[model samples]
Target: MPIEPQALRVLMHLVAHRGRLVGKEELLDAVWGNHFVSESAVSSQIKAIRRATGDTGQTQQVVRTVHGEGYRFVAPVQEEPDAGQPPRESSSADEDGLVSPADQDRPVVAVLPFVDLSPAARHAHVARGLTQDVIAALSKHRWLRVLTGAATARLAGHPDVVEHLREKLGVRYAVEGTIRLDGERLRVSASLTDTAAGVCLWGDHFDRTFQDLFDVLDELADMLVATVEPEVGYAERNRSSRLPRTDLGTWDLFHLGSYRFFQFTREGNGEAQRLLNRCREREPDFADAHAWWAYAVVLGMVYWDTEPTTDLLDDAIQATERALRSDDQNAVFHVLHGRVQLARREYQAALATNERAVDLNPTFATAYCGMGDSLCYEGRYSEAIAQFEHAVALGSHDPQLWAFRTYGALAFLFAHRFEEAVDWTTRAASIPNCQYWTTAHRVVALAQSGHVAQARTEVPDLLEQCPGFSVDYADHKLFYLKRTDQRELYLAGLRSAGVPE
Candidate 1:
């Protein structure tokens, strides 16, 4: 039952003046300010508020809209006092519709409509299509608050676009791009800017054949968003690190924790958990924190080889449940739930949950990775490999690129495509901070493909990295696979590669 921030702002404004009809113009000015979204945006937020509160346009039990005017909070209400503050008398949101102080700590990004530099602006529609697609894709990330395209449409040609966006909309990051159609080829250049510093943090160009405009738009947007999301995260983590540790807010803690979580090490996982714990303590309903904590819990047990105590599993499950309870429609929550289910050896349940996640956010690479992992466990190797490929394509620059490649390697190995497994594992191991298990996959795949001597040569490096390496650990890692022969094949490869026990 997560109400959107804008909707929540409107809701608070209505409730603050309970029983009084608040005019649409007042709400627009208070909520949108100089950002200049249309009245339709206000209406949409009202609709969202009603949906969240289980009230409808027809019923209007909670928020009563005065036709062609504004809205009123007509529901029975009680004034609740803050622990140390006075009873609320005004909206907690600022004039620009930004929610409470805690919420302002979250990163806000705006994707401006891409400029069409084509002849006579012939490709303007394609430019708009790409902008909208990126906006939709970025919105899937639970950690990010993406401004609707309409909110930034008017700022497309501002002389100081970044400063204007920052001053007016409180945007931390802004994405701007230009589309140029040259003959049959389309060239799209996009950049992400840090609004505060007015620095371009990242930039890239996509050149496509421009055969099917929509298809090209989808592909380019997926590529751009996948790359930009990680850059934004990296920027946030760096920004948070520069702030005083003692003054770190909940969002800062969450970002710091997320940075550590992707390091793929036991110590990193533990540190991530500690940070996320502090984050949740500060904001008990921060669904992103809860979801990341849940994933880190499973990571400790699965990838880091920490003992999987019953209590640990329960902790992961409870965190996921809490996250979903806070925001049921979040794709990341569902993806994390799938990961938890996979850790518990609930193969079918994992697959189904991951499917739901992909349905919610098709551009979310991790959801596809979850489905791939679940499919691998179900012995549906071909399908799993396809998912991994799609995931890699969508998230080529993902911070968790190692995980996606490692999952692909496993999927390939499980399918007895040993050469492809070796190739994928090699790619994964080449990534910075990739875990020893990734190397282990390469060794097993090599041995299976009749390269036992070469595999044996790599075993020493693997043993040095993971001092307690053994066939038993391999068995523990692959326990989720339902097919006994699949597990045996993996173990036999490790055995051939000269792993102990």
Candidate 2:
């Protein structure tokens, strides 16, 4: 009786573990890669294996069933050498036992297979799917390089695998986690580790009801991906601070620049530009660096009133274009490109570019924010508000949360929904490190909504923060709005708020 290939593989696996019981789900994942299948499939394969090995369900010999649990190969087994084949050769390893090269310039991360801690070990497929989802999400960013699933699986059960991953796989960071299911509740816990230093950079725990398995997986993956990048950035910034400025690499400079950029202040923006310039000089081919550089220029022009000379605008355009040239698939590059288009008053082009960015990375909150801004400029206020709300839901704790709120407020204001505009802009202003522009929207919304006293009270602070702001500046800012009435409505609100002409 000849056994099927899957059955043969399952038999070999059982023989390797001989005395230990293996769960049916584990066998399914190992042989079928987690494709949905019935338990009957495993039963059929086990029956075939028993027949080929001359074992019976009644005999309790060779393969033995452990009641409701799984199976164990109880009979002794031995490896046989093929007469026609030579001995297998082992792969080369360095002195540290690492197989990959150690001179990687970018941060390399490995997402290890998630451990299943559920009762009866029944959720192995869910754990594996979560691991794969995280890998896929992280791979979309051009900055980080992710290890292959096979490489990560090889190191899964090894003792002291964190150090082994650093040495063998050349990974600077490792993401390890476990999933557990108790009744209908599911819990996921994850930690980001700096392999070189043997320190945990970050950790998080999430709990949700297992109402819809795929939905739960998607929400978990999105939250993890969103948290990981910022945590890595924070870790890298701390690491870079201890190193001499003269010795900083491109990656270090980028992280340091990002730390300053998130401060949302004029001085921070200036320092960010200087550090990113150094990064660009060191590695012109780094697409993420170029995209961020363009973003810095745009922020300076929009918030700081930095004079945007033709050369400066051209440089911003060139930076984003080079980033796209380097990696057209990167959604971040497209977001920056769309921002540049918005600055140029190319509303249609901006809208289309941002849509493509969202299509590339559905979980990218900034892309949706960009899309909202584009729609707002085109006088599509309702549609724009929806996009902004979606962005907020996706990344409520994002570093750019204030920006999303401010934009959402602006969309509502343009739609003549003054109360909502006031609510959102007030929320934006209340957030820590919010830029001064948030107050401008609040003043306009309050004044237009007949709260003249409150609006007037806010004027002194707004003027103190933005002395150069006036009706003319507002007009220039609203130039992107093609509809004359839409632009005039914004100007009238500013004038109502006591803005100087």
Candidate 3:
């Protein structure tokens, strides 16, 4: 009669991407880690989830199949009602299957790469450069998870794949634009697309004298960020997409690092580390690499312990500083730096960093997410919840899905909503992605909520795999639940559940 962990994980992901038909392939990729599983495994799990939810394939009623595409969640979710607390305000879902309108009441957006109409390889470089610049400007939002440069570039050239990109990445809106250069003259155009509606939300074009290249790019960044800023429900005056430093060749280092950064596995993360390290090595003056390298250490740290975490993170701070020095104008670097600052428990500074990042990169989802987290640390629980829920609306394929779930659960736990805390943490523990030491928190939440039997079962594996996992990453200054009082209680509960830790 109980729900299985695997099925529960699928259901959680479904809820995360609920209200829209998610492609089966996307589900496999996001939930099952794609490359390692069989379609039958997914099919089998779907059936199990249906059984848990009290649905049959004939009625396939709750999780409906969309013929050739994928499955969708039809039922509205109830948070199991946190004990002693009333349901919070709810917003209407967004027309874009990506962001529910309720989510918009928070704020987030994705900036796609710009297209290059010129065939010269140099023109391609220009398009990607323009995109990287825009990305930096928009990354200031701490609560946002805007697609990284590489992901946007991958989708940039293929406007035809926009739908596929939307479905797979799970973002509400995308900023698609183009750049064309005619001898001594420049033209740039940008359009905001509601991924689900296939309609342009806003469109604008900029023309500038070729001699004023930097000015032109800056103006374009300003215009684009401003245009998308209000749409995400943030004020235009708060926009601050400036990279902290400007001397570095952001295009080369950023893209190279981005291509390597997505490897996602322990080894992939290592390769990313190597590439970003190289970027730092070559561009010692480049601050962006530091920001990225800090992010890389965070990513590498997420899967397994590779570096002397303290040393790796310290280095991340160094990299972020260099990026800030190069061009302090981009919200990307600011949000990223805020993450590192947050890890250091520079709470006030981190919040300022995230706020600044959002101001620069109004459409940046990670900024919104970071804003929520910073607010949580500041005991702004409701605001933090709004930011987390908003970032979830923007969606992400980050190697850190479990972290997101864990962080969301932590917010609930600390806010003293035990039931909601238990639900989110339990969902996090069941993530099919790489495991982290953070699983201990889920056990802690379960035990605290008196779900001792469940606690007894998960802690042993949590210990064996991430026995020493502590939730401190210099990249995201979240001083996680470190006290062992609850961890010990969790161990006792797991023991009662017949788990040996």
Which one wins on lDDT?
1
| TM-scores, all models, native as reference | 0.81, 0.74, 0.46
Q: In model 2, what lDDT does residue 353 have?
A: 93
Model 3 has how many clashing residue pairs?
Answer: 58
lDDT of 3 at 1: 55
**Over 4 Å off, model 2:** 1-103, 196-200, 477-480
| lDDT tens readout by residue for model 3, 1-501 | 577766766676677567567776566655554145666776788889888878998887679877777788888677553589542211221122232221221223567768776546357777777788777666554334455675555564574655765666556567888888877678888887767667777787877776777777776675566456545432211121222224323333344455555534666567667766775555344454567778877656545446435776687777787667655766778877887776665667888888887666554567777887677766677888887776654434333456666677667766767688777766666665534435655666676777877776775677676444332231222233233443344344344544432
How should the candidates be ordered by TM-score, best one leading?
1, 2, 3
Q: Identify the superior model by lDDT, candidate 1 or candidate 3.
A: 1
Better of 2 and 3 by lDDT: 2
lDDT of 1 by residue, 1-501 (tens): 789888988887677567467877657655675466777998999999988999999999999988986789999987554689532211123345445434445678999999999888888887888899999888887667788887888887889888777765668899999999977888899999999998999988888896677788888887888788888988988887687788676777788888788777888899998899888766665667777898898888777746677788888888887777766677888999988888888988888888998888777898899999988888889899999998988877778888899989988998889999999988888788888889899999999999999999999999998988899987886545667888888899999999998
Top-TM-score structure, candidate number: 1
For 385-433, candidate 2 gives per-residue lDDT tens digits of: 9999988887665789899999899899889899999999888887888
Please give the ranking of all candidate structures by lDDT, highest first, separated by commas: 1, 2, 3
